[model samples]
Structures are given as C-alpha cells and as structure tokens.
Target: MPYYCDLGPGQKVYLDNPGPTTLITLASGSAGQQQQSSTQIHTGPWTEVPQIARVGSGALLRCVTAQGTYTWQIQGMQIGAAPTNAWVADQATPMQATEVGLSSMASMQPMAPMEPMAPMRMGDMQMSMNPMTMRMGNMTLGLDAPAASTQQFCTQCGAAIAWGDRFCGSCGHQLHQP
Candidate 1:
C-alpha cells in the first residue's frame, strides 16, 4: 500500500532523509501544477535531502521513498514553532529513523482478529494460523519448504495445509476442491 500525508491549511511539507527519488505524485495546489525536473550530484544521501513543498490548503501529498524515506510536516505559518523551511533534513521522531526498520510499517493499520486454532495434527506439530510459522506457547517455529516445493498454504492464515484437505484447520477457511 502507498503512504499518504494529510496536511491542514498553510501546513508546509518537506523530505527529511529521502531515498533515490521521492516521486511527488500529487501536490494538490493547481490544475496546471507540474513537477520540476532536476539532476543534481550529491554524496551524502540516496536521492535528495530537505525537499520543501507548499500546502496552501488541505491536501494529501503522495510520494514514494526508495531507501531512507522520511516526509516531515512542519508548521509553516508559525514562526516560533520552528524554521519556516518546508522540509527539515535532520529528524523528527524516533519512528522516522530509517535505520531501525520502521519506514515500512510507519502507516500500517491494525490487523484483523485471527481465528483461534483448533487441535489438528500436522506431523506432530501444533500448527498456528501464521503462514509457514507456528507458535507453541511463546516460541515460534519456521517450517522448512519441501524439496519439491509442493506445500499448500491456507489463504486466510497462511498456515501449511494438506493438499487433499478441503478446509483450513487453523482458521477454518474453505478451500476449493480440486
């Protein structure tokens, strides 16, 4: 899924630590608004750092990050708050630090409730709903793939299922009969 940033009126935007290219798909200011073309040689970051964007009104600025992507929103109208510059290069929150592997799940929503697993025997292993993985008490196990790689997985919970089985014993998801 793509990330979205909703900015209020007069709230400017900026790129903190960007990747190779932060493509601004939607700026939401003018119908004739065109993305400026540029080619610069930089030695520090991947793409570019400290990219500023003006937000006259409310808008959803959509951009893609390749390596280190951190889009920061600052109060442009307020002077005492911070710099008037749209984008700041340093950092904001600890979550924005791309070094900790948080950029991928920064805008993630809550996961759906998983169905309780029923007692089913699969090679003497207590299989759970997670795909190719099982949780026994607190320890988790990662199942190895077959040499032929003919393992069938449940569509709902990603648990390994028998090829001849109709319903997923882990999540009770119905499988199409072949």
Candidate 2:
C-alpha cells in the first residue's frame, strides 16, 4: 500500500504496494504545472519492479520502492519528467553519457555530447579518406595518370588529375585523361 506524507521542508515518503497506486495532490498551481514541498522516497519491496504505468501527467508518481533509484519526481517539476509507462522493464539501452570524438555523434540531428575515447593506434584503426579506397595500414596510395607530362583533368567529380596517376587522389575518379 502507498500513503502520502505532508511534505515538510525536508520530509520523506516511501511507497511499496502490491498493486499500483495513483498520487494526487492538492491544487498547488494550474494544470501541467504545480509546486509543492520537497520529499524523498526510497522504494522497497520488489527486487526489480520493472514496470511503470502512468495514470496522469501529475498522477503517476514512481513510489521509490528500492534503494539507489531516485525516480519519484515531484509534480509540476520538469527536472526529470520521463514519458509515461517508460519503466526499465523493456530492456532497452540505458542512456549513457555522451562521448566526444565519435564520428556517428557528429551526424546526429541534435548532437549530444560524446564521451572521450582513448587515443587510437594507427595499426588498430581503419578509416576511409574518400569513399573508394579504405585505408588499411600506414601506407601512401598512388593512382595511374597521364604519361607524366600531359595535364589531365578528372572526368568525374571535376578534379585535376596529376601526371602518371591513374586515379584522382581527391575525388577517386579515373585520372587517365586523353
């Protein structure tokens, strides 16, 4: 069963119910926003009560039924307002701290901060400078071009091709221009 405590300056409340209970409060303010006193609850009862069902925006309060789960958010408080029924029962990826140097993080629409990665060695890393040639190890790649004399322009991607190079180093286009 769950009960409400008069939240004094630093009072606390805990909820451990066999079935779910709803948390209703006196009208502290308007809808979608309310202010109240501060209270803390430490959930106890289930080893992993991994399901959450939201009755209302302000009604569904996660009664702290265990230690270390500080999830009983106060109503009208937008600090940690999680989506309704989004408890940890679904076995989804936990939101980890964002990293710093990940290439995939750069392409995110709203980029999140990345976690710092250890420095990578050249032998353990494989990256692509362009799209055609994937770099394997520490080596310079050369392409076939004109006979080391005639100026050649890349037919594709509009890049200049060096003499004796078979491919455009910049755009990876065929450099053997006539």
Candidate 3:
C-alpha cells in the first residue's frame, strides 16, 4: 500500500510504502518532481526539517523540507513490524471421499463406537512413597518417589521367589499357586 502526504488544500503526494531499508519513490504523480527516500523520512538528511517524533502507525507525521511542509500519514507497510487490527481464521480444506487406488467406501469407513473402560479394583494394596531432594543453585525441589519392591517370598523359608515359581531358590520348598 502507498502512503499519502498532504501537501496543502486539495493536494496529496503519494509515497511508496515506507519501509526503513526500501528506496522510497514519489509514486506516480510526484515522480521525477522531487527526489525523496525512506531513509530521508526516517533518518533524515533533510534540507531544513528533521523528524519531530517517533512516527506511530496510522498517525500523521508533520515535517518540513526544502520542497514544502508535508503531513505524511503512516498507513500501510509501517517502518517496522507492527500488529494489524484484523482477525483471520484458520480453516482446513475439505478432502474428497475417494482415493487413487482404494474404493470410495475405503476413505469413508464407519468409525468404531467407543466403550467405557473397565473400573480398576485394588484389594489390600500397600504403598510407601520416598521423596528425593534435588538441589540446583539455590532452588531445591522434591523428586518423585522410587518404586518399592513387591517381590514374592516363600512363606516357610522366607526366601525370595518368582511369582509362578514352584519351588524356592534358597530352600527347595514347593509354592502353592493361588
């Protein structure tokens, strides 16, 4: 978009988009009449007048130069990255119900109905949580508990055994399967 500068009553000079690094031109009407650049408006090697204040987006900038006084309006293509007051929605494109190799029904398969998960039942479960202290610089944080051993032991000899073991390792005791 172009920037409009008010020269006087019933007069406007269109300037090329006002970006800092871009070479600003006096867009169609004022072309070749006066030589001006974005650097001249922003940084200013102006003949007499320099920039007055930090130019706001969509705000009028009043400045004077060898050409004349100009009331340049900052509209489109701002000096830097600025937020626009427009809202845009993101939407997905609709896909066709047919594939190159597969049949049309293959792309439109019936979804499986979801069922409720079975409720978990824990009978006589014993747990002990051990929190560990972690130190980083001056911040100290507590870590998650380490898992406690739930290994099965032989009742007669009190020897550690696998859950489905028929006999204990330490003593050759036969284990009763529950």
Q: Per-residue alpha-carbon lDDT of model 3 for 1-178, expressed as tens digits?
A: 3334443333333332223312222222243453222323442223322221223323334333444444433444333222322211121111122122221112335655656433332343322225455444555566564544557889889988876888988888888867
Give the residue spans of candidate 1 off by over 4 A.
1-14, 19-73, 76-133, 138-178
Superposed by TM-score, candidate 2 places the C-alpha of residue 25 at a distance from the truth, in angstroms, of 19
For 1-178, candidate 2 gives per-residue lDDT tens digits of 2333323333222233333332323224444554433322223453443223333443233434334333433344332445544454343222222223222221234665665544334674544332223345666344333354455677787666666788888888766544
Decide which is better by TM-score, 1 or 2.
Answer: 2
User: Which ten residues in a row are the worst by lDDT in model 1?
Assistant: 34-43
| Top candidate (TM-score) | 2
Ranking by TM-score: 2, 3, 1
lDDT of each: 0.40, 0.39, 0.39
lDDT per residue, candidate 1, 17-109, as tens digits?
234443222222333542222121222343322333434432222222344344433332221112234433342222112232222222233
Number of the top candidate by lDDT? 1
